[model samples]
Target: GRHQANDPRPSHFEYNGVRFGQDNLNVFAGLCAVDTPEHVEQMMKVLRDNGQVCTRMGAYKPRTNPYAFQGHGKDCLPYVFELAGKYGIKVIAMEITHESHMAEIFEALHQTGDPTGVMLQIGTRNTQNFELLKIVGRQQRFPVLLKRGFGITLDESLNAAEYLASEGNRKVVFGLRGMKTNMGDPHRNMVDFAHVPVVKRLTRMPVCIDPSHSVGTRAAGPDGMLDISHVVAQGVIAGANMVLVDFHPAPATALVDGPQALTLPELPYFLEDVAIAREAY
Candidate 1:
């Protein structure tokens, strides 16, 4: 069943002791294909300089082609925790591809002495993986970030969150990563900005926008930072409690998703725009 617009679910949830809801906004920089410890440091510096610390550091890459640059895997988990600690990042988001991977993730965290903070991410491709959802819901150690599937409807999106809630782990944050459409545009997907407010009104969970995936474009071309900034601002004004942006110190040299990633130099301006937008709401 759909969540009634008037449903009495909690509107805010705490992650690592910090609350996220109407008044607070969580801005995360997504580091795609971060393969080395040096890259981790570079990304952390960017976030720090911008007065932002937390990031969506990709430990596993869900690539379509076998030849693509998959992420640094388990070997890089320690670096993620270590570097995040050195930089004072409060929360770091990492993907969990399967139920089996959960053990490995935990083992890595445990070895690292359980870093500062962690958020388990259910990538867009695994949003509807019921088995994984059930497992994540049962384990309440970390909060879950559930991204919207490329072409999934709002009902399906909410239902996916329900899977986690049903298992008694209601600490779920909903992410809107745009939708698949036949539009002939350079962007990777058609970002459904309207859904931001809709999700906010329908559920008690916090809503986030993934502008990097929504406004996909190669960095070699004209900068799409402006476009991304616009959508992020729109999402925030529409009711999003967080905005996830993919950024690389050198986007042109990124192993994966370089086109949609914002270069280090461009991030500050975009973030400034986001700050202004945030003030309006």
Candidate 2:
């Protein structure tokens, strides 16, 4: 593997003083398509009730359709920061798409007084956007979360992380959100569970799995939660340092990724299963 051969292994890193790659399991509840203060409050309550303290929020959504919900843009960031403070969340992961977005992010941080630590996420669509990666790497103000592209190989994924590290920012986390495959039986993409340990050994960066997108199933009842719990448990046991799942108060009306979003009621049980799985490791 190129990662194993040429790359200098990344050491453990911290976000807001919480060290990853240790015994601690970082659980990031994905809050996708959040548009208003009301949604923020609702999601915050759900997270706090379950003792979850970190979230992957998107104030900027890049959609396939121009008419689709393009998130609330950067204006809603203040509300996210405000609610994150009220809920005591320590880390918030948000995506950066262009060089111009850097100014908006800095302005939001200034206005919100930097309530919680911000992690710059490079979504699957932008995994190979080297220009954006280099720009973000130069900032060095926050850590980077690089999700593997659905169609990219393991080598390409590692190289994407190297792009950031080459720019002198080594605080990078790799997200394995499943790779695109021909099998379309039950999930959107086939999750390569074996990649977890391989990535840990090759890059030494903290690895997280996005089961919601990987499984590609909607929560109907306890059965849906069961399906999600199964995959999440497997990911943790496979050596993932973090787990990222999407949850909404009402998925039926969620503006984005509704089918894969777990309803609020099912979160506690899912988190319990994740905790037990991490203990097994």
Candidate 3:
């Protein structure tokens, strides 16, 4: 069943001062995965200079290829937190696959004296991981960013979100990360930003759009419009509360999703374009 359009459940989800929908467009930009200390520092510094505070830091990645560069994990937490703290990044959206990863993250937070906050991310691959969903929901220390399942129906994805909210953690941001279907063609995943408003209407939860994963490439289209920029504008205009995209000091050498990651130098223009799109909304 769909959540009632007028459901009274609080839809005001916030983390480190960025209130979804209530505040200005929230953008979470950073590397798809933590790379070198220099790269992280560079990206964070750029973000700080540009007046952005929230970012995506993938400490643990869930990949289809078992041998893929599966993130640096807990080992990179200290420096990541240190850079985050140093650059005034208040919150980081990070993923946790296994339940134990939560403890590991908490430990890292403890070691860093909680300088920066982490919003637990449940990637699309784990949207239906019932046990993990329950574990994440029970914890109140962090908000949850639940990406729609890459291979499931929109209704099924929303139900999966219920798995988290039912556990009593209602501060959830439903992310539209496109889908795994081939109907999208030329692109890696189907661009699903059209559902941004539908999600808002059907549930009392904020909506975020991951343009990076949706298009899975930073290439420009026939119209000379970069695919990422176009998709981002579509979501923002559709009332998306947050934007999650990827950036790297050097995308060419990025360990994962290199082709999809934007270069650091291109960030300001992207931000400007996104701001314009937000204004259009």
Candidate 4:
């Protein structure tokens, strides 16, 4: 928490008139400890409360602390999707670390009509995970959210995308969260800002920015919400095809990454600015 530095001031607010970014964004409302029928119910509640039509449902969790919940794993997936239908929330479940779990991932999709399509997110731990990538790509039921590694170079990051793309999975979506760990600074991870445009130029697929992880703090500390507006706008201008912003109905009460979440009122207003920023690109 003691690692904040004087970054540039947030840019002026600008609302562009673009119809939409290259790909319309789907805010990922994650459920980490969803292990029972009750957790499923809570998922729907959050979705409804936020007016969120869908989410990335995590039945099996990977947490840094072992004391954390590993979730009900595959046991609660169907029930999760079942509740989603009951609440009209499209469900996206994560696969277990083993190929054996692929069965359950597809099963959930099949049972749910797959909604907007299940997403195979390659988390930081899975950046260089080729075996997993090949396996996820093998499934045709969903798209992917390929998060860049903490310190992975831009080329290496794009190359991971290339591997997925080569498998003919055009639905691959690239995510950025910047690299700052090796620098021994607490300035939050600076997303590979240039990746926004670089990936767009090298591949025909879509790209989006994950700014919550970029600056690390969700609150607009000294600068205010304009800080978010400026960073996202510049990201778009720099060639980010789309944005993957994380927003919650309430930030302080969030179970995960609460500090980084933008308030509900903040999202649309921010998107208005993002839509405008994207128009400039």
Error of 2 at 219 (Å): 6.1
Model 3 score (lDDT): 0.88
Task: Give the distance in Å from residue 15's predicted Cα in candidate 4 to where it truly belongs.
Answer: 29
Cα lDDT for residue 183, candidate 3: 58
lDDT of 3 at 149: 95
Better candidate number, 1 or 4, judged by TM-score? 1
TM-score of each: 0.93, 0.92, 0.96, 0.72
The CA lDDT of each predicted structure is: 0.81, 0.81, 0.88, 0.60
Q: How would you encode candidate 3's per-residue C-alpha lDDT over 1-281 as one tens digit per residue?
A: 24676566567866677676523468999989997999999999999989999999887988889999999999999999989999999989999999998899899989988879888899999999999999898888888999999898999899988988888788888999988775537778988999998998888878999999989887898999889999999999998988999999988999888888988888899999888988888
Note the residue pairs that clash in candidate 2: none
After the best TM-score superposition of candidate 2, give how far the Cα of residue 102 lies from its true spot, in angstroms. 2.7
Q: For residues 47-72, write the lDDT of model 4, one tens digit per residue.
A: 67656664555566566688866657
Where's the lowest-lDDT run of ten residues in candidate 3? 1-10
Predicted structure 2, TM vs. truth: 0.92
Name the candidate, 2 or 3, with the larger lDDT value. Answer: 3
Name the regions of candidate 1 deviating beyond 4 angstroms. Answer: 1-8, 218-225
lDDT by residue (236-272, candidate 1, tens digit) is 8887888888888777788888878887787688788
Among the numbered candidates, top lDDT falls to 3
